[model samples]
Target: MAVAPIIVHPPLGTGGRRVTAHGRILGLAYSDGDVIEFLRRAGLPDAEELLDDPSWVTWRGGRAHHYEAA
Candidate 1:
């Protein structure tokens, strides 16, 4: 298995804080590593692939969102 390249996106909010797909606040965004860790904690398979692909992630109301890719 290979590690997918990280795709950096702007933080969900003005303060650059981290939040969940549902808009639940997590904390300040630090690095891609933190996102990966969050995904891992959420038990999402192919977390790296999902994070690397912009199509896999979305944003609404300035909140980061994610869903299963078709």
Candidate 2:
């Protein structure tokens, strides 16, 4: 399967995940909204929708929408 260009890395011990697009660090996202904003700033046409799109976003080490890291 083809991987998504945007990668939302696992949440850190302190909190929030590292967001990257093609290895470019966008910002740290504590919530989905943060991710959208970063994408919007990065010039993504439909930033918010990209979250639900598997072909556009990849959530690693945790379930989507769950920020609590075990």
Candidate 3:
């Protein structure tokens, strides 16, 4: 597979971070749990643990799993 196929985009001005897979939008994540849920729905049952795995997820505009502005 490709590195960071899943991307958690920067947080929006209001709230939430956009989550995408292969450039396809999956949903917005307001929390780490929300991110995990999105990944779970995308077929990654171990998303919670994979949150810090750069090989699977790429965090942009902020720290990994962080949905708040930096």
Candidate 4:
């Protein structure tokens, strides 16, 4: 058995406060794609696969803050 790789996200810029996703602190990257990529690269294959899902809402600044559960 081998350990999986982790891609830690930078820090979220939510009015100076950190955002919590799945109970973990989120980091703000330069773009939303980065955040999405971070989720994928962070050993979350399902996160990467959801990029094309209609529920995925990526803002203009690469921020997916308005994500709604579908």
Off by over 4 Å in 2: none
Clashing pairs in 2: none
TM-score to true structure, per model: 0.47, 0.91, 0.87, 0.34
Tens digits of per-residue lDDT for model 1, 1-70: 4323333335443444343644444434455556666766766666666753655443333334332221
Error of 4 at 26 (Å): 3.3
Ordered from best to worst lDDT, the candidate numbers read 2, 3, 1, 4
Give me the overall lDDT of model 4: 0.42
Off by over 4 Å in 1: 1-16, 59-70
How far out, in Å, is residue 21 in model 1? 1.8
Error of 2 at 14 (Å): 0.5
1-70 per-residue lDDT for model 2 (tens digits): 9989999999888889999999999999989889999999999968988898999989999788766666
Task: Specify the highest-lDDT model's number.
Answer: 2
Query: Which lDDT values do the candidates have, in the order given?
Result: 0.48, 0.89, 0.86, 0.42
lDDT of 4 at 65: 43
In the range 1-70, model 3's lDDT, one tens digit per residue, is 5668988998898888999999889998899888888889989898898888888888889666667755
Ranking by TM-score: 2, 3, 1, 4
Q: Specify the highest-TM-score model's number.
A: 2
Which residue runs does candidate 4 get wrong by more than 4 Å?
1-19, 52-70
Report lDDT (Cα) of residue 53, candidate 2: 90
User: What lDDT would candidate 2 get against the real structure?
Assistant: 0.89
Q: What TM-score does prediction 4 earn?
A: 0.34
